[model samples]
Target chain A: MTDPQRIWTAAAVIIGDEILSGRTHDKNIAQIATWLQVQGIRLTEVRVIADDMDAIAEAVNTLRAKHDYLFTTGGIGPTHDDITVDAVAAALGIEVIIHPEARAMLEDYYETRGGLNEGRLRMARVPAGSDLIPNRYTGAPGIRLGNLFLMAGVPHITAGMLDGLTGELEGGAPLLSEVIGSWVPESEVAILLRDVEQAHEGCQIGSYPFFREGRSGANFVIRSTDPDVLQSCVDTLCEGLGELGWDFTPGGI
Target chain B: MTDPQRIWTAAAVIIGDEILSGRTHDKNIAQIATWLQVQGIRLTEVRVIADDMDAIAEAVNTLRAKHDYLFTTGGIGPTHDDITVDAVAAALGIEVIIHPEARAMLEDYYETRGGLNEGRLRMARVPAGSDLIPNRYTGAPGIRLGNLFLMAGVPHITAGMLDGLTGELEGGAPLLSEVIGSWVPESEVAILLRDVEQAHEGCQIGSYPFFREGRSGANFVIRSTDPDVLQSCVDTLCEGLGELGWDFTPGGI
Candidate 1:
């Protein structure tokens, strides 16, 4: 495999009070991370902050500046508290404007319902000169401004928007992983795993241990952008475990 | 209640490659956030970073300086990949050493299973001058260094550590919440929620919309530090919803 200087990376800012308050459990971090991975873009960092405009703006500025791409979820609905667009716009030193296409879409969607009211019109607002990401689940569209995409807080709605955005991103090679699980305590085989990972040119190993079924066990996940390298790292680790007389499962327990 | 300039806040740095790679869904953020709320310490920010030493150390330094307390979960296990101890020690410019109590606990816990070997001895290591947070689920005790805590990546083990450290930290008044759920779409009642919240000082309302029972619904959570004020806010919100001809459920949907 050829050497690469850096991997394409994305950072997510989860904007909401519910998540931080623990009233609502956050699923967006995992979702966005998974989606970015499939696109060959690694999600490197995630910050869950409150709905405060200043906090949102500061986080947006910091993350967008640092990563190749940035995403924000929450505070995009048709409510007074939904302030992501305004916050993001302020951060970028731009104005918040109602996107005509978004307004038209909402108008059409609400035609049979109650029609677009002043509150419903809030969903049409976006950072100046931004486009829209289609939302098949709900009428309000996800906003996209350059490399920063603002999505929904709702898990299923976020999934829909992500689906609409699949393959729309430019990314590098996708990372491949192979998992090996064993009842052996991770401490017993830490060195073996590390040595195997070090021996492999482009692979890294992650150990996740758990106490389950009345026994201590761990799953070793070997990751590499190259599928062949990932496979070889897994094989080497498996061979070492076999030599140690430790029983392991190939696909994880 | 008097308006406070800043709430006692804490930030969490989840250090692991599994979470970033989406191979593992993070539960520590919610667990820690919930635990902090009960202790009157608001979990203001959470940054999930990679297993890289530089990233973990930088995040720990940045957040520890910003908040009253900072927590890190994951990479505290008995594996080579578990470098949280080494990374945090580097960040604090401290040395790493084996804590005698932790070593003794491991020795006792593993006496019948397997004696403390080199691999298991990894669990005994801690940053210089640190104390141990007891773990009932496992032998590896959580590390406590000043206002920073290093905890296990596993949910149950982390829970055990949290249980052991409950009420140990100093904090302010706990934030209280009241939930009012309705079948009405949030946009239809956005203005009402805003008006009620505006009229109620020291209170903020968050709207969470969901789809259930083949219809769209929303839950408005009113939060405040004062119980009387929280109750008043909930009462006002309920009155507003009733006036709008919407049937609502108390305590959320």
Candidate 2:
């Protein structure tokens, strides 16, 4: 029989030379991931590529086809390297066009700032048959083509764009998670974690070990779509840790 | 004509669940990218995937075949969730074996602490015909099979592994970059930046716009393999910015 619960997955292509060059730390991956989680979509994979058109197009095409939704950030500005629109259009095998609403927004925003120039006008370009994702912070609206979303590279601007798209997409049940932290080495409790996870049908446990303040510790994150399964798994894990003489914090360390 | 300079490229596959869940912010991508730059290798692409065997193996196979070198971080711990070795072995179509050296190191490390158990012993497992990358911080050495390097998920442990591999790989000329920051909107100077970049044969400019302290500004990073070309490009850009009556910081603001 087919699965009762539909799993919605998404992928993000972070297009920027600055990030690949290590000149800029990317904040969009986590930002978008968190946003997608809230939207009941799981972010399955993320690829960070350069500003090159071929690379951008290849990543966009490949990821957009594989996942339920694809999000791209960066290369949507007015600079020469801002070739996301062209690359995405090429990826979709379509022409790039200026959205009337986007152009009007740019014109209105830039009217008192400096008026639209060739560079500013470039912000209006998008893939053919696309809608606009509003950018409350910037004049340039984000482009949305089918299941593809092109957002700003700037973290706060991307945040604004994500805010605009919230509740607009259809997704499955949101994955729920719980964390338990303890001052114990993960190796000591590996078997217990494995056993507990296997015993719970839908729950998966992730162990994150850390060495802090001259001591070893770990935080166990348990995830499941079902709340009942999630709670039972957490209880079993806590019981197992207690049996092993380890103290664990429910909310993590 | 064959180019004398060989451009070395690398791709990274970050295997983890915490990162995908947005429960943990990834620090390895930037850290690895910066380290690769110092080794004169360009990190062309990076994929962050969940800790699933199929996902890990697929990403490994695809990226390792495409780039000069491939690096994977995460999923190398002692827990059941640490499946990087198995995934990588499957990807390479090799059998997993316990490296004697790694096993001995783990035994020695755990002698006073707790003695090697099944979980701790799991750290010694590696793909066949593999060499070890020294991990000074922990007993578990990173596994190196051919051009693939599997490192720890922890940032500090990964840093130690990267240190052990520095200057060991063959590479081309290191890319050099200079940044110029100005209190000007990028769109206002987009044409000048484009023209200046086009005039320079080998240099590529990346514009990063920012709105800070109630002012709009941008930092233009100019990169080139040749130091002479890089300096010339920077001089030309500074001159162009000056000609436009805008003052720019040489070392960036």
Candidate 3:
């Protein structure tokens, strides 16, 4: 009873006070979303929350139940504010246990740099019945419990962890997209855009407007799982824009 | 009697499919978070959801009820995908209507650029009984209804809207922060960080680790509502790092 057409969706919880405090501009949401798209999964939602344990647990529980997979970035570092592990454990109602393999990895990683202290040892802890996601860049590995992935706050570290988990998750057909840009204001051709989208089934068109060099313009992105449908929609959209007396670029502006 | 020491909090919902699909990197979260911090309103949480109506409504209702103010960005353009007005109306159990002032403003703005068409007029639509937040950069105005604010997705336009509403909201004591950087492994001094944070009654220390130029370093940011407490916490953290034989920078790396 497997539905091949079912869309696999995922959600992300970005945990950090620095982000909520406006000190750090988040890079993980884009990084993870792009990576997930390559794996044929759609990122449906993202929540950027503080380091509070209750908020983390609430976001984890809510998003995990609604999506096939839930990913969290941040709060895995060896510091006082690093509370993601404890919060995720509490969310799953599981005990936190130190993984022996992770402990050994940290021991080996810090062998030349520094010895494993109490704070460094804390990174080895994971929720009960969880597995480790390899982090080639750092000593401590990412945590994977059921459908929840606990990734590092650092962008490069999260990239390495995601690289290890690539091709491991089950996904549906990858969503394909084509972009067309025009210098004309979007409102001038809005009705035509709507008509073309209505005529095309299985394709969704997103219009993003911008003002540059004292000129109004917009980039229309057409997305569909089926290549033929996406192509047809793009063609019709381009034809419609042409008829409306607007020149459009093949790719986005 | 109202408590003078009460901390005001706000939450933001970034409503866009572009952001969720990683087609566009989000800028509103940080912009709004920084603005709110300066206004003495703590930005507690942020949710980036798709442009779907139900999703928009749900996020709006959930966050609006929990915080003193809730702001939403995106989905307020002339395209069919711009449905924030309708979705917020549904969330508030109200109707969407064309604001006369907004419509007049648009008419005047488009008179020179182009005549107002059906699509252009769509920007004037707002939730019932909502006030307008002026957008000097654009024709359409941002919507403000009760504790909810609907802003533009474009960074500069949103900046214009935020500028219009600056100092209009009730706020409390602005949070003060100081940063200190050190070229040392955070794990080596983790215990000291925890103890220093514990001793500082009203201060929070956030340790952000980085590796650059073949060296590991961390920037510790301490925040407090009281300026005196913030300075004291920074002094204590610096003392602790100095005692550990680490050369620390007064400002962050």
Candidate 4:
């Protein structure tokens, strides 16, 4: 997301059978990836694994060691199907313990609603030396075990955890981007896109095509850690598009 | 997605900068996963990586060797940024060659639209010793090199390729499922879900909670490779729900 020497990378482990079964469409991957960019960390890789404990441990252990940070979602709800905490603990070679603060928080939150029971208490289990990532909307706080952050599977609940983590992690310069949308089919200007991308060192361009308004269109997204370089790439692309006689929108359509 | 003893698993490599940058929400993972399930292959792992060559190769090589099958989506378009073919070729220690049939397909398809150009020809390239997966909608065919399937990032085009692939690969019995939606908080019925899942050796029930129509509700999805086990699990869950004095919708809300 920043200088080559200082780029911060993160990997996400999405733990759920529902996702792998295609019963639930994933929303956390995009949300977390977007949020990590604001924190100046590049979301380098993501793994969507099932609810299996061995799979969970294997993924978490592999990713947590390779990247600067690893974030996991799902398998931490009230039901028996929710076994993320146990799996992660097994992976880390640590004992699962009831997090006192989290237990207290849940106790207080559920006090006004239904009293906290054994099923709800499942939310309090975490690795022996883990900390809590605050959750504003729900009783269960996200788990932070060293470099690994265990979050909720629900999109909105994961948003609450991310909101609590804004500007918290150490990261490098933020990645900046500029998008140019045009009606011209990307194939028409493929050479031009290639030349522009090659001309910039710190920048990379992505072409996303869409069919809208009964015609083909594309959004050319230029990304770079350096704002000046990004702008220059955008300018050069715009000039090339102009020379090609393609009407373009500065942002996206 | 099938019998536990004969379970077949797959991993997907989503090659793109757009996905990691959060510019595009990926639809391919769910589509492929659902398709894989119907074929009795479990979608075990998914990796969303950048457009970098090394990253792509590392992911492809690692996943292709580990799983029974590996799929890749994105970076197969007609632009320079579309380098999935080259990257995958490098991964398998093979050279990138233009398949003559794919080249001819493009020539015929583009004859009525625009003449085939150098940019358009890029789609014809594939790893050495690869076969074609038919594309009924687009000119460029999907690539199949042994267990690795190189597919389009676009949803509908990938659908066409998948359609061509139906009943082609050997698979076990398909996983069956039944869903029961109830207007009860998940915490209230966690024990019931646990008991039902335990009673059925081969079945698993996942609780997906949602808030709708001024009430909290959950969908208990019971899944198993055996249809009878799945149905029994669903029936047991329904009986439990009835015993708990909770009304449930048979399918889902």
lDDT of 3 at A228: 97
Q: List the residue pairs that clash in candidate 2.
A: none
lDDT of 3 by residue, A27-123 (tens): 9999999999999999999999999999999999999999999999999988889999999999889999999999999999999977899999999
In order, what fnat does every candidate score?
0.77, 0.73, 0.76, 0.72
Error of 4 at B191 (Å): 2.1
Instruction: Look at candidate 3 and tell me the lDDT of residue A77.
Output: 81
C-alpha local distance difference test of each model: 0.90, 0.94, 0.93, 0.89
Instruction: Give per-residue CA lDDT, model 2, range A1-253, as digits (tens).
Output: 4254999999999999899988899899999999999999999999999988899989988888899999999999999999999988987889998899999999999999989999999999998899999999989999998899999999999999999999999888999999999999999999999999999998999999999999999999999999999999999999999999999999899
**DockQ (model 3, Cα):** 0.86
After the best TM-score superposition of candidate 3, give how far the Cα of residue B72 lies from its true spot, in angstroms: 0.5
Candidate numbers sorted by lDDT from highest down: 2, 3, 1, 4
Off by over 4 Å in 3: none
User: After TM-score superposition, what is the CA distance of residue B126 in candidate 4 from its true location, in Å?
Assistant: 1.1
* Candidate 1 structure quality by residue, lDDT tens digits, B1-253: 5445457999999888888888788888889989999888999989999988999999999999999999899888877788899999999999999999999999999898778888789999999899999989878899999999999888888888998888898888889888899999999999998999999899999999989989989999999998898999999999999998999999988
**After TM-score superposition, what is the CA distance of residue B42 in candidate 4 from its true location, in Å?**
1.9
**What tens digits encode model 1's per-residue C-alpha lDDT throughout A1-253?**
5346458889999999888887788888888889998998999888889998999999999999999899999999988899999999999999988899999999999998899998999999998999999999878999999999999999999999999999998888888888899998888888898789889998988888877788888888888988788888888999999999899999998
TM-scores for chain B, listed for all candidates? 0.95, 0.98, 0.98, 0.94
TM-score of chain A of 1: 0.96
Best by TM-score: 3
* Per-model TM against the reference: 0.97, 0.98, 0.99, 0.95
Give candidate 1 misplaced runs (Cα > 4 Å).
A1-6, B1-6
Which pairs in model 1 have colliding backbones?
none
Cα displacement (Å) at residue A243, model 1: 0.5
- Residue lDDT tens for model 3, B1-253: 5576899999999999899889899999999999999899999999999989999999998999899999999988898888999999998899999999999999999999878999999999999999999999879999999989999999999999999999999998888999999998889889999999999888999999999999999999999988888888999888888888999998899
